[model samples]
Target: MWGVRSGSLVRRRQLARTLRELRVHAGLTIEAAAPLLDFSPSKLSRIENAHQGVDVHVVRSMLDPFDVGGDRWSEILELTREASAKGWWRAYGLDDRGYIPLEAEASTIRDFTVTYVPGLLQTTDYIRALFDASFRRRSEATRERDVTVRKIRQERLTSAERPLELLAVIEEAVLHRPVGGPAVMRAQLARLVEAAALDTVTVQVLPTDVGAHAGIDGAFTVLSFEGLGEPDMGYVEHPMGSTHVEKEEDVTQARLVFDHLRTVAYSPAESVSVIERVAAQM
Candidate 1:
């Protein structure tokens, strides 16, 4: 797990959760607390939301309003510093890869795809083909960088230490898409079978006959952390943009939907058989 050791993303979220709890425990809301510290409510709210990290001195000032000090105060300040640290993904300068940073830190991923193969299970050829099909052309350097990023992300699945556990349920239509042509699709499907054989990975296929199933809304990934303090996250991407779902209620609903999808999808072994049969046909 990327977060099992150093984790800026998880730490930032953890800090935000703690500060929000502390403010509420002190009987103050963002609007009320901001005035006491001469801060705009939005600024303080952003800090509590982990959108921005405050300097240690600013944190001290913020904590004073809540009458917090001693060890607890020091702990939060340490967390703030940790949260402000750069994540491993930043070294690659992946500004366009919106979800990789979070995905890297996640201990587990529960993905349900209605139209495409999950990134973690895609073959190199399949990856390049998807990029080639993009409406906007990418330079060779940019394309290869993305390919490298995907390969690196896949390492977590087979790591000697604490590999990431993946549970994926995909629509049967995904197998028929022939994303990169017959050869590429065959290799991609074969890769799925290979990955599913791992103890950390489980793949299931939702049959075409399961009409109007639970995941009709589209694809979404629910990422779970080590549960030390960080909450699970729900990520959804669309053509226009992507957003992270952080609310406890919404994330819980995502989990519930995923659970239902798993139930209606083929069993792991049966799913592998389905994938093999499809690849054979290809």
Candidate 2:
């Protein structure tokens, strides 16, 4: 999961410490705690590691095992409340945990991609084609659910507030490859042409002739906010999971790399011509 937001790592650590202390004070090992909660020992371990959260019910049950009283009960209740207050991503789906809320909250998104086309600009046919590639291993119901969720996620790009400013630097090859075949590629490029006209959107293509560029590291998004206290954050995804980096040093380094990439990439007009050229070839 991307690192915790709103709450600090310190708070998570404190909660873990409190859990451990309660367990020890009650003269129980995690093995002893597991049966009472009807959970595995690993479940308790994961909760303590901050890999999972403890709901109010579980916290109440855990407290029952210990002999704590007075303000302690309410304090633990408050902590659990903070932990369980549906993270911003909850509106879409309980399982999406894709950092979508974090991305939506961001004011600007600078993206660089070289593999499949980025999600925001994907046509339904293109998206279905990409989903089908992965659905070979999934059940039909699961595949349908995945496709539906992706379409909902894509809607954020045009939401009423117009909160996000998206600047994409994509490789020429992405536009050239026909995901759902030639006809689908043509429609996808045409959709791109329309999306590029949005006031908050900018598209640039990194041509093959550019030789080399900084984005070769991998696809990444740099999310910046608009406020006195907000800091820029960088997100990187892998097949296994995603990472969110918000430290000043990391954001600064990614900004420098992206700045260099923007310089080497074709201008927006040139990038549109490149797309037209690829579409014509298809």
Candidate 3:
């Protein structure tokens, strides 16, 4: 458990969902509840947005002021307690405060890589080099833990039930990069060729000769979930951190960009040929 558990995030989201339902049932706008709670509208908004955790006392004070029924208050209090419980990821001394919970729930992943292999598909040497290079400033122990977490995350690719559907478009340069030297690069490319054969995995290459592409902006991921429908999310990672974009406008933009990139990328068979050629050169 190196990150927040999926259950905790779902529980927290549920609190907001529940409150919204209650507000709709009561025929009141969020604005009306602000004056009644003696709190700022923004405070209520933050709580409902799942951006802030509500303490037990605070929950009691706020809901009591609203004259919500005793049974309803009890139910909400239980939900709040569930939401506040420490997630399993805490046990591993890793902060899942944001990233883990969201990734754990994604059912389909579409990503474009400009500089390196995507985490889920990376070989051990590539991953080791990636972590070593990434955490150049961290202690050895911290870096090992971080790398181990990434391996655990990759389990989703092989999971029997509800295996993730992954569609990755990687730049040709990624296959040529010798992260851990020539041997590692060859083995990694071989693995990529094999992995591409898997039913759930689709690998495409955007060749350098293609000249221009939509993914020139940088790497991005689109995570889709079952039951959530078409509300795709976009994630952009930087050297220090990653951010999730949930706004419809941003998601739409990411989708359009991905579609364009895919169109320019090599077909699965051609991508395999490119990887095989790279491996043979090594």
Candidate 4:
């Protein structure tokens, strides 16, 4: 059996892809593989879909029938172990940790926000104020945990190993909205200006004057991975829960919408100017 080790969400996703391909290459369906592995079809399906993790023993069992061995088999076993390991966010006790892992693993992130600032670009004070105003009341401890999580998420932007490339387009109205009052907004705008200066980050503003735009519908983020052989993921957050869109067609549509928003939004230089002007007003 493969040895157990720390698993990352990215590895889980990669393992899912490899397992599905192996099954196809072996000319077996989920129905056939399930009985052979003594797994329920749904359980096997979930593993292939990356909705759950697979043990090293199970991975070896599934691959054994396929006559898959050598480096490919070893690689999959390692991924199996890594996929079972918990991410840092899991310790936070937050209910919905779906998006952070994807964000952490993404090589490129494209975001469009119609309301307040994107979480990745938000300031500490701005995050506090937004949390306070949220309808679902949270304890101070919970709020602090939330803030810590956001701060940790921002580390990827400045990571020495693999800095994240962020392309963020925000609505002009967001700049005008007073989330944390003048001082907070000023600081937040300043942070945006500074972040925009970074080589890995780009900030653009969608002027309110551009009425009836493609992004008028709502906000979303598209996360692209680095050589993971996984499809780009699309995330849509609503009042109830978030939706992760994985279908190629849906992901393509989200990408197109982001692309259109990019074309309509102000240039980065103009955006920094607008941010500075807003900060001066505050």
Clashing residue pairs in candidate 4, if any?
A: 7-82, 7-85
Clash counts for the predictions, in order? 0, 0, 0, 2
Residue-by-residue lDDT tens digits, candidate 2, 89-167: 4643443344665564566888888877778788888888887776257566766666676676566567664446788
The lDDT per prediction is 0.86, 0.75, 0.77, 0.86
Minimal lDDT window, size 10, model 4: 1-10
lDDT of 3 by residue, 91-183 (tens): 558654566555666778889999999888888788888777764576778777767777777776777765778899999998888998998
Q: Which clashing pairs does model 2 show?
A: none
Clashes of 4: 2
What shift in Å separates residue 158 of candidate 2 from its native position after superposition?
A: 2.2
State the lDDT at 205 in candidate 4.
99
Error of 2 at 252 (Å): 1.6
Worst 10 residues of 1 by lDDT: 1-10
Residue 141 CA displacement from its true place in model 4, Å:
0.3
Error in Å for residue 89 of model 1? 1.9
Instruction: Compose the digit string of candidate 1's lDDT tens values, residues 64-115.
Output: 8888999998888887776666666666676423788677668899999988
TM-score of candidate 3 versus the correct structure, residues matched by position: 0.80
Backbone steric clashes in candidate 1, count: 0
Evaluate residue 275 in candidate 2 and report its C-alpha lDDT on the 0 to 100 scale: 85
Which TM-score value belongs to model 4?
A: 0.90
